[model samples]
Target chain A: MTNFPDIASIRKDFPILNEVIGGKQLVYFDNAATTQKPRIVLDALSGYYEHYNANIHRGIHHLAEKATGAFEDTRRRMQKFINAPLSEEVIFTYGTTDSINLVAQSYGRKFLKEGDEIIISTMEHHSNIVPWQMLCEEKGCVLRVIPINDEGELLMDEYEKMLSGKTKIVSVVHASNALGTINPVSDIIKKAHKVGAKVLLDGAQASSHLFLDVQALDVDFYALSLHKIYGPTGMGILYGKKELLDAMPPYRGGGEMIKEVTFEKTTYNELPYKFEAGTPNIADVVAAKYALDYVDTLGKDNIAKYESELLKYATDAVREIPGLKIIGQAKDKVSVLSFVIEGMHHQDIAVILDNQGIAVRTGHHCTQPLMSRLGILGTTRASFAVYNTIEEIDSLIKGLHKAKKMLG
Target chain B: MTIKEAQDELIEDFELFDDWESKYEYIIDLGKQFPPLEEQFKTEENIIKGCQSRVWLNAYMDGELLKFEADSDAIIVRGLVSMLVKVLSGHTPEEIASADLYFMERIGLHQHLAQTRSNGLASMLKQMRTYGIAYQAAE
Candidate 1:
């Protein structure tokens, strides 16, 4: 069993922990869906909306300038946060879905042709899947998916076999949202590069928990959602190698995204703005810095250590509960734990847990294809964050006992 | 004037039945209360994509008032339309434009909904708001 994290001081930072749900203190385990915002993030959002409520880049006024400075500051902060090569490589988009769509629309449209293949793992979220499917359908490209083993780890042999001269792009998630499997992305990147295929790592789940240095990994592209990292909704960042980013065409055409526009001829803006077409979720983007800072303050290693302990505790506790089967037992994993009771419906379990003020994500988790591969409808997923405590896991264990007694 | 008033109406109507199942039965019955929309409104343009239940929504501006006609393939979802119409219909463009949606939470309608269903409701509301904006811009 791993050592329990120092969570007493951490819990004090989150005011929402004091909230009561169904007459019980909320035991929020759905950190994968979206994390609870800390006071720093909330304050940053309020500070922006109340004080610097103006659009960026174009305006020459005071608040506009302040907003513009704050916005670009986030780009630089994100660059250092992920250790990107440069700020220009960072494209602010609307979460992971939008980031993947941007890549598929711009890069896939520009580079991929008929009979060219794109590879992805079976563990990819639907966000990663649908965009490629749309591109493949539009361009006549073939989408070749790398299958995973029963443990939810990518089959490297299959992946190696799939990579050839026909392969153009390989997109895969760095960590599984439903299964918590930490994919061996560095090795995957090296292999893909040897085959001359560009790689895009969906870092949505890994951004908050793992140490991400895009340059060190030499990953072609990386996409992450700020909301899942304890930031506001409707914001995400995409990091690409400068050459590839510059070569890609513009995603959306509008005022901020163009240098010049005529009815007949239009010239797009440079790098990041080429993908970001209109006024963004300015408040959220500025406030995301606070979320990043919050993570930095706690240190990802320390947080991971604490969460690993919690996962082991929960895993061992649930093992004693008869008829509970833990899914995704990959040797290397993050803090997510997913399972199914022998005879209980996932939704029924969720309802009962919610009644006891525990929140766990129950369903396919936008990985219906993965669910099909696993031969199950869905599993109840409880993902951990920095602020989650072992006591919460104890509550979950108690709740499960109640659930088994009531249902079994 | 507020969602509370509408919720009071819902509760009164709910009292005419018992439990969520019978309330749902009443809601489906109320869906039958709406006039069948003209067949032309059933075109692809009116269909709301990404809904688990197939739903069609069409709206037009009658003077300064915005009128909407909606339908759904699912009985349960059509009941949602019934709730929306009672709260949304026969109001001025501005009134329908500025109505508070957090009231749905107060009534606990959205509190129990699946995320996708909640998203669909939000999309339906946004579509209604867009209709108002289009009419206002035209005027």
Candidate 2:
């Protein structure tokens, strides 16, 4: 009945929203970790398995052709979704962690050398941080960190000062998972490129909430986890500039990654296949297209607009609660409200919320370094998506009030 | 009580709550039963390696019984640790080493434990059991 993208109908599409826990309807606020897959994306997964399940890109069979077509269809879809320069630039991997590891192992190992410096930020997930650290350790490179201010925004002036000839690569998260800070990756990319460093933006958090355009961002590399974007788990994409991907060596050397194999020398497959070794996640890849379509159908602009409202509402509501403090108040952010109660532990708050069937993520959220940087162990995180309604936010507020009475 | 008896007692305790809300609240309440781990026991060796929060567990043998003192930065995990200590401690080394945690699944608490946290929990139990086995062998 009401306009503003018909949130109720959209909520119904997510079947898990109907889950009754503790005699209450499920209120999912953990979108930053992973999103609930819609029925359409689910159907595509089963339909692929039901009709045409086969190893992609080799067989002359009909099912193979259909599957190969559908699987490749997702690559093109992702290319369009992010407005990449070429479909060949889209390389499928396990998830963001795999994608980051690919860049670190293949490109980083090949190019980076002793005394070289790589710049990362305090807010990166461990997946992003560890791979680079491993690469740095092997290559004898120095890892430089971009410091953040009290508000969780990156210190741009400090980042600018750090840019020099020794800086070989600058990798950072586009949006912080813990803080919800929308980083100025465009500026970071530009400055790093000026210093001759190839920039890799960890787009795992941003891809779900913000409009992504690799071409527009002109990033050397960008990693996305499809599960964070409402697609199935175990599937994601690594979007690299065509030239960089071509220049980088194969990540994993196995089947479907080589053209000719012999005892003497082997020729690697071109573009994406070089990185995506072995049999790819064919079923999940095919369904990922429908996930993108669902996002496109709802419209990112619309989703952002709606989610922003929810964020604002929840922020206001939580402020009214006694002894609660919001964290990560960046000037630009995406719909995530991280907070801490004065005396209550994050897990206690999380458990109490779970009791009320209002699920919110608690603890470090895989960003322990960020938590340490902020001088706190962790915060109870409530993130909003397109399907979330104000009513749900009210329930969260009410639940927190009860938590205050019990735990405070 | 036997380890099995302790687990059965926990299952009965959880069975009193029909909904996950009350069950979780009761679990949180149980955290208070755990005496905080001694400052000396909070050293790096006793810390669990993976987490959204830090958990420290220390084990020692008194006669045949293995006593565990544990603490967590997160209260809910602290509650879980308290329950584990209740069920696993005060048992003979062989009994502690061989105890099967069937009550975890029976009480439906297994579903609430994340794969990572469960792995950490499993590791904590393993550390305790390994300690018991080592002490038993030493004796």
Candidate 3:
């Protein structure tokens, strides 16, 4: 038996894991949707709202000073977490969707012209797709999609072929949320750069599983949510090359984002504040730094190594269950297992699993087009995080077996 | 009307009707009770965009309350619209704005709805509320 991290010790950090659901300990398999935060991260939230609840960067009061320092500390922490070239490169938004929308509106609207092609893969989330579609509608640009094969891997040759002189941008996911395919983003960036196109990565699913160095990849823009990585909701990071960020237009018109404002004219603020317009989610942003700290303590490599083993174990075990078909069986994958039973509806399976205190995400997963591409209505997706254990995977398999017998 | 009368009216109209099939029949039946909206009102402006079923919502004010008549092509979605109309229509603009819609839980309507279906309903309500807001502002 391989030596694994102590499941009991790890489970202790999350209070909700101890609660009985339907008279059983909760087996949380819905990490991709959102993660259960550690006590430290949770405490950081209450600590912020309770102790230093004030608007950041504006007031000269003591609470405001404290709030400003802690809020900026998160930006610095994110800069280090992603190995971003500078702290100014990090901009905060509501979440991944909001971050992507900022890029689409600011960069895509400004740079893209009529007949310019914006290329994206078929595996992108609706967050990545809809924003660009909105831009294309506004700017009269054509949206080009790179097709995926049966295994859910991007056809790299097809991707390269799709790029041309007219290709203005290439935006793709760093890791597919549904398929768990860890895309070769570096290669994609290099290929796009050769064609004089900027590349943006939807890093929502990759931030926890992979170590991101925005400078190394030379990725033009990267967007991800902190909630999906064990932080609070309503906080996300958008990292851009400083020059690119400096050149882009402001996303929203609000209080914090202006240098000087009058009825006659308005001058926009600097790189990050230009993008972050409103009074930001200060409490959540402060808590988000602790999420990065938690990941840092684990070491990304160790987390990936353990998760890869868990994935293999899950795949092998699930393959044995009769009439169960795992969706998206790519060789390179994160710890996501999407599957469908021969006769059972994904929703029915989810309800049955819930009865057994196993939580999993069911339905189109906000990737309705991908579901259409796969010829399935939806899937039951079980995604793993660093805190998830093989024991949890065992519980999931057993629950499925019981659910099949009961619902089948 | 008393809260109980309103609650009973909603329950009788929505829940006892059962499946979206029966519920939609009730909605189409409700459309018969309201005065006719002009054929010209069927323009794209009155259309609710994200609905899987084609829906047309038209409204007018009667004294202090706003009254609406909505129609849809699909059965279940039509029934959903009927349920919304029952709770939302014939209420003051402020009342419509302030309604918590905890009624969805009572009807067990949203519990059975898919995410898309839920979102569509929410979107339709948002549109209706926006109209109410505009009407109130104009007043």
Best by lDDT: 2
Best by DockQ: 2
- 10 residues in a row with least lDDT, candidate 3 chain A: A1-10
Candidate 2 Cα errors over 4 Å, as ranges: B1-29, B99-121
lDDT of 2 by residue, A208-287 (tens): 88999888888999999999999999989899999888899996889989999999999998988988789999999999
Instruction: Put down candidate 1 lDDT per residue, A129-171, tens digits, no spaces.
Output: 9999999999999998889999889899999989999999999
Candidate with the larger lDDT of 2 and 3:
2
Please name the candidate that would achieve the greatest TM-score relative to the true structure. 2
What TM-score does model 1 achieve against the real structure? 0.77
Q: Write the per-residue lDDT of candidate 3 for residues A285-326, one digit (tens) a residue.
A: 999999989888767888888888888999998987789999
C-alpha root-mean-square deviation, each candidate: 8.9, 2.5, 8.2
What are the clashing pairs of model 2? Answer: none
Any idea what lDDT model 1 has?
A: 0.83
Predictions in order: lDDT: 0.83, 0.88, 0.82
Tell me the tens digit of each residue's lDDT in model 3 across B1-139. Answer: 5334565677665768655434434544554454444677766878764413356788889998888877654334555676678768898887776666655556555543444552255667777788678778878
Where is the poorest 10-residue window by lDDT in model 1 chain A? A1-10
The lDDT, on a scale of 0 to 1, for candidate 3 is: 0.82
- lDDT by residue for model 2 (B1-139), tens: 9898999999999989987667767877887667899898899999985455677898887776778888887677788888888998888888887888788788877754444662266667678888878877877
Report the Cα lDDT for residue A108, model 3.
Answer: 88
DockQ of each: 0.04, 0.52, 0.05
> What residue runs in model 1 are displaced by over 4 Å at the alpha carbon?
A1-6, B1-139
Which portions of model 3 miss their true places by more than 4 Å? Answer: A1-4, B1-139
